[model samples]
Target chain A: MTTRSPLRIEPTTPPDESPPMRPSDPLPALPPPKPDPATVPDPVISARSLCVWYGSSMALKNVDIDIPRHKITALIGPSGCGKSTLLRCFNRMNDLIPGARMEGTIKFEGIELADPSIDAVALRRRVGMVFQKPNPFPKSIYQNVAWGARINGYKGDMDELVEKSLRRAALWEEVRGKLHKSGLDLSGGQQQRLCIARTLAVEPEIILMDEPCSALDPIATAKVEDLMDELKEDYTIVIVTHNMQQARRTSDMTACLMLDEAAVQGGHRTGVIAEFSPTEKLFTNPSDPRTEAYITGRIG
Target chain B: MNLPVPSGSVERPRWPAPSRFRRYQGPVMLSLLAICALVTVLTTIGIVAVLGLETIHFFRESHVSLPAFVFGTEVDPPKFGIFPLIWGTVMVAAGASLIALPIGLLSALYLSEYAPRRVRAVLKPALELLAGIPTIVYGFLALVLVTPLLKACFEPLGLKVDSYNALSACVVVGVMIIPMVSSLSEDVLSAVPRSLREAAYGLGATKFEVSTRIVLPAGLSGVAASFILAISRAVGETMAVVLAAGRMPNVTANPLRSVETMTAYIVAITGGDASYGTPKYLSLFAVGMTLFVMTLGLNILSGLILRRFREVYN
Candidate 1:
């Protein structure tokens, strides 16, 4: 019922018109602090100066981020801001697309993931993903969960593993009665949980979620966010979300990316990280004016 | 003063006014319904009347016993019967379907899953072109080209050669029906949601695993329907069999031996000069009726199979 206009920020003034703002602005005039390379936590996966191009168009520009271990990090941005594209880079899922090219170092577990020595199949097994929409194979619920383990050549006790994974996903009690039924027969929330169970069955060290709750109702979204909180005790999670509330609720760290109009080429566009910080600081007291504007619902 | 004046006001009608067009809606709808019912009944009656008359005339003039018409009789001129022709038709159809099913299904898999967009676009139309070629042309090709090629290929392998045999006819018929099977199976394969494939890939499964475990099983009913339809086409084919299957009404099951299907036998008998109201003349109708029954049975079987295992995705 209420329409709010976006807050527009003035660009940097030309040198001829006015002198540049002094080092002392109203906001705390601190220099960009660089974390000491030795003190910084060793990232399980890190991308340095990452850029992606589609044909002649650039989609990402010099994105540098480090994913800490055993924690949930959220990528929050407006639509078409390349959060999903950056999330997909962890396991090289972007390789499936045509005419997509990337220039960067994606180090997974201190090893360069994009190097020729790193097998894409093995990397995907180690880092699993759950999509925005609940996509269950047209199979029995049991088969849906067992498929990952089977493909990964797990020759262990599959029955126990399936049960354990389903229970971890908080879906075993509800779905155990109907394990033989088609996975597609479940409710939307149950299907998404089943997909999480399927991903967990493979025992991946890290999981990437691309707007996992965007297709679900509020209740389902709450359940998934709760699951993500529970999952972070064991697995590193990287989630892309447009819901700032969800990022505030579930993530320990948040990275906000915005499209960089200054970097656009011809008709092409690119996204750059506008801010990255602890969730509490980013939501309650963002340092950047643009970040403050976004968090306050003044601009998106 | 106003309230007192209102007591004497006349009442208006309770019903709303109807427009002229609204008043015509009921009668127009009823007339359309009547016309549709009439057309359906007339078509059904026309088919039953024509087939019923011809069948009765055929049975009356054939001089063949009813039991002998269904099974075979060892009478002097060998009374017309459906047992041998039905066996031949089933054998040819089954053999042809066996050959076409795997090839068509695999090719469909390639086109729908593996081929790039441009290659698929070109390949699909080329396969459909195979279906559009006239059956008469296939028959000619089977007679003049395929049979000789088969003979040449088989002579060195220590197999006897018949110029017109079930082997050549079935092979050619299978080739003729390839496009139907591939196109129908391709449609069913493509109808599977892309999310299913993505889910499999996300699980670290290879492309082959995804295709075999997910796509094929999902499309099984449609693929089975396509196979059944291809078999029905093969059974009902007359021109190819007539040209290549050598009109011998033998009850053998060997594909290498020359055989006559029900349709080919009917074609052979009808194409010959036999006086009207004679046993031989009536035999054509008997064979024609047998062919029709076989095809109808196949169609019903295919429909039942499709209904039984139809997959529902929501």
Candidate 2:
């Protein structure tokens, strides 16, 4: 076939659309209007000047954020930005990591969470977590759901508790047939749901998820997103995601993290929040240049 | 206008490569491995054959009636009863298990779950060093050091403890096998995925609860295997038992009394006490067979327990 005018180049942008330039187009010099703290409801958990160090080096620096109750807050960052580390601070999961140390105060439910007098185990009972990958215990489906409840001294009908938690996680119908079989026998998505059911069985008021859908298929990710939409009624959720689309799809509030370069903060390249706002405001009208560059796929 | 084609094609040999190295290596290597496998089977069959022949000769020539030899305890003219030896072996193994199971499992938990990295790095190799120490040293320690201490402790309780008693051997054997159980169980416990621990900790479980409930159950197969292997070592233990426990064939249930084990009896008879080819010498083979059977039984028990309770992960 003869080449016709060396392959015609057409505008990919549709006529009626804004041609994708509105987000990046230059406007009058204007700064993001900071939200008034008085108008916003009191946060369920608030971090003040939070800093974290690993051994002799810092990992996070001056991270201040408020997590609203019963609402989903998404933490988006590039790799090594310490989003997972911040999630761990909520229930003191960082204590398990050796040489990990934190500075500054974190208030949960208007009560300071970092006080030495607080028991981590008790705090964890009130705040649960799901990990990046599906981590179902090598146990029966029923036992996986019931273990957290039994350990937390749930005196209620355990059979009903397991059923209720599974239903809440939207896993009961899929796993109801094989309650006695090993949880490992299930697919990756089903196993993730089992972990969610296990966390729900503890009756935590808040849940921290570290990229919960990273290891899942798109269908499974959509299912989890749907589950989060329903779960916001009973549980405050904080999630760390590299997928910016996921933050917009599922979260009410969004925070973007970037590397703290040596140019401003000594020589260490720690992680710091570049911007935090409502998901719609953050995506449609980002406050920080770095966040816009990142969300637009310009930066790693 | 000619355009240059991209040279991405890989070079291929036409046929019958001049280099014959890779072609003949497979069967040659397979034959070498086959020989190695055959040697193991051959050695096992050879040992069984030798032991079996002598064991049968012992029964036939000794004429110490099988039922009587097994049941009767009289040994003046060599009644050849094995009750005392079996009892001694069982007691020492049972005692070793009692001591090693708790201490070894607990030490394993500390090493696997609680110890900091630097501490584990120093402690783990040191613990394995205990396993490297010769059993002969343990035997000497039991005879010289532990026996006296046990005697003194029992003296206060009005029990007459012999210089060569099963208690001393059992205690020393327990110490000897501690490393085996602890190290193997440590491996098992550490092999339990970090995700399980995170899940447990996320549920408000303390360190104690996480270690005991989640990690322990997850590592149950390896932990149970460690105990079985330790007990088998106790049963087959020769040098330590022979030194600490006297060679006297006294069938008694008391731990304070000196007792002979199958290994000790075999050693005593084979160490020139009985002439070669005699029924007494042949008895060594029979005792070896019994010890083999007992250890086999223990391994089978371990396999069954592992199969029943194993929560295998991908």
Candidate 3:
């Protein structure tokens, strides 16, 4: 809980210039895409008519979302609204849950993620995720950052990669002195940042965070929020949140999911997208009445 | 305001009183539980006392040399050495563990990490059934079936093995404890939280890497404990070793040679000879004491390994 603001004030670029990390930071690094008002930005990931089912009952139906590159996109709604489900879809992380199934197309870099020819392992190298709770591996903080990179055949200087990732997560100042210490020994906020650093060492193009600050105190939450804002300069982010203000404060665009009231097919209520717009428009002048009620705290 | 403040001084807080039965029944039940717990401790001490007293009597009353009795290989008349039996016990247990550890742990890994629900439901209980078979049945099988098979395999290769050989005992003992190791290891592996697996997979690790690096390491303490327990079981096994491994006091490391284990010596001596106060009768207690010490050491080692590597999950 020590003051964690100085790292944010500093620039995120590597201090001492070294040869670029090629294995992870894809060849010829694409500059972070600017969200220009005059032209439409290309979607880093585009899901078309996505439907998901857990066993027999449908969880989500015909949900479409275009997540812009190098910008924070927030998914917000009440519980059981399938916002987290949609976030996990970006990395095909839903495949891990038993009996959970998905249909329709989720395309990343113009390739369908669900295609059998595409390798999930290689796909995950470019699309990483941070979980709802801080889950740093039960290893030293140094190892926690180095493990993914090592397994992915990172041959460059691991020490430099570990330092740069920690700095990017805004966790370097507190933990650089104790890199060999267990990641589990950190406070809740630090642990979450360590998890983020673990994801960053792999050098993914997009990062998905599922309520990364829900377990943190207000001060720690602010620290992570600041880090997220800084992260958008390099990585495309998709975040799921119950906190509407967090969506407004951190994201460039926001998507709201709502449960279907009418009987879909089975007797169960299904979740679908109610609105998708720029964060400002979604908060202040939503086209959907439901989004306005949710923003104003009239209904959830 | 609709709410009214408390008037004057605050009264002493009222508390919910316990029912008469709730208040009075605790001591009675707790005493009953304490008695049950004390029974186990008392039983262990009673066994040790019986063995120790007889062992001390044997050492003192007999006109035998202590070093010769311990280190000698002869079993005729005055010198009754126990070293050969201890060596036999260690060799057989070690040989059996060599066979059991990898096969059992791999089966456990399959059940916990790779197998589907249908496969696990059928496989897990079938393994436990292997453990529940009577050891006497295993002894009968070893004597009748396994020894002949070993002789058939090795005799043509020019190794001589008796009808009752240590190889039969070690192999059968290994098979018997496969279920013991597999079942215990499966339980421990299953206790490893799924969140660790998810984290590894999210990092792009395959199922193999997740099971081996993440889940296996996290569950090390429990796996090590199961291994120690299995070794202890192998050390104390009696009936099968008696029927399969012959009653020869050969202390050699050759597994194909006929040998006698500590449990076998204890059982065979007491079955048909000498008065209660005789040196031969008292020898059984000395051997039993040695077996108890060996198992106790293993149990302590198991605890140490468990405390050192146990990964705490929040």
Candidate 4:
């Protein structure tokens, strides 16, 4: 419950420069080493040694990180870099794909999510997701928002929940007047906001968004970014984005991934983490050369 | 000075002359359009003219009472009427569709939603084989095998079953038309955008829920059209009904009782020796026209429903 902002003022290195520690600029110390399990506070989700493979090809390699509670963390990377793959692993969405396999552990609220005994349906109820494209069922706006709650056996004041969720998504004012209208009738940006509202109605602890604003215009993207900032007060948010500026604007922490060489047998692309740090530090003074090059637009 | 400058201004480049081949394009295109229009009009006129003239001649020559023809007429000698045949046709078609709809839709659901890609590839072609088998073969199988099996099943229940009855014909027709329903239903179900299913899955819906709630509703129009087409085929079916549905024109509700269908009656009178101008012979065209009108009506109704309810996801 502590908001500790320990500014780790590290020396900024150029993209092509060597890793030299400067005496004047004190390198920011990493967070205190994680406490033992007996004393450790629970993280919303902790992915340890997470690796994913499709058939013979590896998509994610040895990624270990903890997503803190009630904060927005953004994963920024180039295309085919496995950020989406890692986000999908949180809810086992990869299971739908043929030949997809995973190794290592994903613990959600201290429970091993990849365990065979885990019920995926209940797991998804606690961790809802919003895709890049706005896909509302060819149904009324009310029905679209009510779907997740109804499916999860929600037995509350549905009308209140719907209004509150839409308000939380910053979409109620525009859409409340047309609750009975088709979801598809809304503009793309409004539709996406409606999707966020739908996801919120389920009362999930964590909300995973995969480039939620990539398809939107600048104004729409800014609106969603603002919405994310407000939502972080109550919900843990994990988002993947190709836009580096979006990562800087909306995230408390940033993790940058880059594609490694393909596997010989299957030609499967593997992704490796280049840098993971506080957003301000990562964007202003990156530790890794690849991250510096990527943020500055010198290389993809 | 301005006018003189315009007159001596640079002359535009002359356009190239057309090739000889380009000259015939207009006539050729017009001729093609005329041929298409002529073919369409001729087909429509030909069908209407044949059905209309034959129906008129049938009514003029036939001495059968019109009321009895429409709604079962009982005479001293049990004179011919179309009401019993119409009843048999409707009964068989409706019963067959009832049996076929669930099985066909389930199989289609499995193909579209459950089966793996490789398995679906193999299963789809295998199911299509049912459509390729001739209708006469189904008629033979219904007569030779289905009739006996029904007798054994019904006799124990104290039901008086005829060898050729509506039950056998309907069951055989259901089996024969399974591919039509399944194939069309599969296409429609597959046409549903994958995004919809993914949306449902993201909402924590089970596969069964996604299929039933989203896929089925999205494809309802196509499924309805398939049912109507299958039923029309069942109604107009001649060889199978003639062989499996008995020739006796009994207006009974019991499916196990012997009955005659309109198509079966037409086959009966036409197959036997009869003078062309006689009342008995004119009865065939009347029955044919009635069957044609009924099937056409069903097709039109199905088209209307499809236009009304078909989902446009784009």
Which candidate should be chosen as best, given lDDT against the real structure?
2
**What docking tier does model 3 reach?**
acceptable
Model 2: residues >4 Å from true position, as ranges?
A1-39, A263-267, B1-34, B64-69, B75-78
In order of appearance, the predictions have TM-scores of 0.84, 0.89, 0.88, 0.85
Model 3's TM-score against the true structure: 0.88
Per residue, candidate 1 scores C-alpha lDDT tens digits across B233-257 of 9988888877877777777867778
lDDT of 3 at B61: 71
Candidate closer to the true structure by lDDT (higher is better), 1 or 3: 3
User: Which CAPRI category fits model 1?
Assistant: acceptable
Residues A1-300 of candidate 4: C-alpha lDDT, one tens digit per residue: 110111333255322232322223232233344332212236688876666777756788666677878888899988888999999888777877887767778899877876756777777777888889888888789988998788778999989998998999999999888998888899889989989998899888899999999889999999999999999898999999998888988888888887653231234467767677878888998877778888999877
RMSD of 4: 8.7
Error of 2 at A154 (Å): 1.1
DockQ of each: 0.43, 0.64, 0.43, 0.43
lDDT of 1 at B198: 73
In candidate 4 the C-alpha lDDT for residue A225 amounts to 92
Candidate 2 residues B1-314, lDDT tens each?
88775465336434556568788899999999999999999999999898888778888888877676666676433677787777788888888778888889999999999999899999999989988888989999998899889877889999999989988888888988999899999999999999889999999998999999899999999999899989999898889888988777676778888988888887887678988877777778877887888898889988987898988876
Candidate 3: tens digits of C-alpha lDDT, residues A1-300 = 111111232254331222312122222322233232213269999886677777766677666678999999999988888988888778878887777767777899988975646778877889999988898878789989998898888999999999999999999999999998888999999999999999999999999999988999999999999999999999999999999989999999998887754323335656777778899988988867777778899878
lDDT of 3 at A63: 69
Runs of candidate 3 exceeding 4 Å displacement: A1-40, A264-266, B1-19, B63-70, B75-77, B306-310
Kindly give the stretch of ten consecutive residues in candidate 2 chain A with the minimal lDDT sum: A1-10
Report how far residue A197 has shifted in candidate 1, in Å.
Answer: 0.7
**CAPRI band for model 4:** acceptable
- Per-residue lDDT tens digits for candidate 4, residues B169-223, read 9999998888889999999999998878777777787788889988898888888
Fnat of candidate 2? 0.82
